[model samples]
Target chain A: MQLFFFKSINLSSMEVFFDENESYHIIKVMRKKKGDIIKATDGNGILLEIKITSIKSNKLIGLLLKKMNIKANKHSPDIGICIPKKTSRFEWFIEKATEIGIRNIYPIISHNTEKKKINYDRCKKIIKMAAKQSNNFYLPEIKNISIFKDFVVKKQKGFIANCSNIDSKKFNEIKLYNNPLFLVGPEGDFSDFEIEFAKKNGYVSINFGKQILRSETAAIYICSICNNANNFNL
Target chain B: MQLFFFKSINLSSMEVFFDENESYHIIKVMRKKKGDIIKATDGNGILLEIKITSIKSNKLIGLLLKKMNIKANKHSPDIGICIPKKTSRFEWFIEKATEIGIRNIYPIISHNTEKKKINYDRCKKIIKMAAKQSNNFYLPEIKNISIFKDFVVKKQKGFIANCSNIDSKKFNEIKLYNNPLFLVGPEGDFSDFEIEFAKKNGYVSINFGKQILRSETAAIYICSICNNANNFNL
Candidate 1:
């Protein structure tokens, strides 16, 4: 069953209205007619089973048959990482992270991989598709690009994954509290200054084992581990 | 230092030779002339630091300056997954799985995603590149695409990850004696027949969590968990 995205729906009224763009997709693209059954999520934990009731004035209207809330109360990982130079690599990271279930994703410009810009619309579309594909109702917020130094200072504390191999703690040994934010480094890894600064501020250094992984790979791996942790729920 | 691939090299000979294709890459593509140093691995366990001693007759020859073993002795998860329809998706799985460290990789043809033939050369290239990118010396062996029933009937047992919520064991709770093989399902998940057949043959059903993951994501997630396990090493 394909899951569609509904930005907003009136649950109490038991109605759903698709805008011009979505209407075109439903009517023209998908050829969904009146009485067609469809499932959609509002990205705010609400999943609605809707039956297309009317198509008028280039808009699609439906009556909500059922409503289900996907509990988003679970404290999952919110990732903060330096984006890779390859657009596909970074996009792949976003797709996998969304599928694996994350709360928020922050693209950090570090000393190594700095000043990389990500298209917000593209990221959002990818996230939406991944969520729909993976049956995840909670849409992770994509934050604007932030300087590494500024991000660390502002977030205060989290787990930073690096390749320094100095005083690094195994992932299993680390104490995961609520809403853990992972700070993964770029290609060459975080600079000495960046690591030291984060550590001083309370970001514990962690490694996903001994192998050296790509920036995007590291980010997704972090998500995988977080999703599988005992206390966590996706 | 760039990591190159050596299909076979003699340690006692204290010399390295690049074939015609590799010679073209070193001399033309990479623009590495005599006296230039390079690092390579035999994709078994040995990493070598070699210095270009001669470039003659379209062959690149070097003297081995250093030799180190990557220790392939540690047991790790060997993944057998039904190949995804997208070539890039399967390639991504191979790359991430290699980076995260796997003992062997099998692309299986199952009921749902049936008989998808993977390009062995392309997969091997990706695996080699991933191993080099991750600085992993133990290159994972990419096995031929095996029939699902034939595979289960032969292998006898492994952990099968599916969307089915039946009597699943948490990954941490699963006993990992050595070289645990992970069978991850395709997009729609394994056919009920496949799951039941495997179970009858001793396969334990497992789920990653609540979220449904892509076949590639599930394969990579299994690798991540295996790498972080206490007894495993990359």
Candidate 2:
């Protein structure tokens, strides 16, 4: 069944509607008409069984025939990373991370970041598509690109990765904590000054593994480690 | 320092030469001149320090000055997966696995797979570029596309993943023994007959995680788990 996204889909009510983009997809591209069964979510935990009520060109208003089971997001640690230089690479990370059950993805922009602007709308669409394809109910939180210093100082248990000679604890070696955040640097990586600033703050320095991974690669790897560690019983 | 790939490099005498591809990239793209220091690798274990000898339009030959280091590929468990439908998707999996230290990659062609032809040259080039870009000394062994049944039965330790009601063991739940082999299915996934056939031939059924991942996502996820488990005690 086709899945649609709506911000405030009230399952208690039998009526539902879609955003302009999603309505266009269903009405024009998918050619869905009245009485067509489909699925929808409110970007929260609510999953609804909706049937097309009417379509005015690209606008799709539907009837919520049944309320599907409310599903919770997976229990993996959240990973907030600095967006990479390439948009396709960043989108690739989002797709894979959604499939692998990453809770949150906050795209941070750093000083050495070559790619500054991000297409937030495009990224959100990719995440939604990936979530539906993977049969996952959770859509990871994709935040707007923030500055390095501001992101590092956020109120969350964070880890900063570096290539310096400073010894850092391995990811799996660390104790698992729920809703953890890993800040990945850009292609040139975080500058020394930025690392010092992060250190002066509460963020701890950590090594993902033995290999030197790319910015996007490190993001996915660290996300996987934290995710598995949470589910893994010692 | 810039890095270049020389397939015809002879590691025994520390002799490494650049062909048109490497030469053009170094001279025209990187704007490197004579006497410039750079690093070159054979996509094997050998790393060489080369000083530019002659800068020609067609070829920029370099003299091997010193042996920097011959770093061996990390001792991680081998993972062989079926070639996915999209060429770029398969290439993406190879890139991520190579960065995380996968020893071998066997691109199997399953019965239900939509893609039949494997672009070995293009895929290997991507792997080599990703390996060098990730500062990896060794490239994963890229095997030719083979039949799933033939490859699994012949391998020592084989596993197949499928969407069944059976609750298979999670990847990290397993103990490490020999290098592991995981057969990831295509878009439609492995057929029921294929699953039963693999099971009869001594292949164990295992799940990557709770979420349903795509073929490429599953391949990279499983490789990370196997490598992490193999190096757990170290």
Model 2 Cα lDDT, one tens digit per residue, A1-234? 556786455546667878898888888888888998988876566788887888886778888777766545334656667778788899999988887777778778788887778888888888898887776666788877788888777743577876654756665566656566677888777888888888888777776554677877787776666556645642
Cα lDDT, model 2, residue A80: 62
CAPRI tier of model 2 = acceptable
lDDT of 2 by residue, B124-155 (tens): 88887787777777777888778888886787
Model 2, TM vs. native: 0.85
Q: For every candidate, what is the interface RMSD in angstroms?
A: 2.8, 2.7
B152-193 per-residue lDDT for model 1 (tens digits): 999987999998888777665677757888898887799888
Model 1 Cα lDDT, one tens digit per residue, A1-234: 667776567768878977687678778877889999998888888888999999997688899899888776355788998988888988999999998878999999999985489999999989988987888888889999999988998988899999877988877688777669899899888999889999998899988666888888888877777777732443
Off by over 4 Å in 2: A1-40, A48-75, B6-20, B23-28, B31-37, B49-77, B230-234
TM-score of only chain B in every candidate structure: 0.91, 0.84
Question: Whose lDDT is greatest here?
Answer: 1
DockQ class, candidate 1: medium
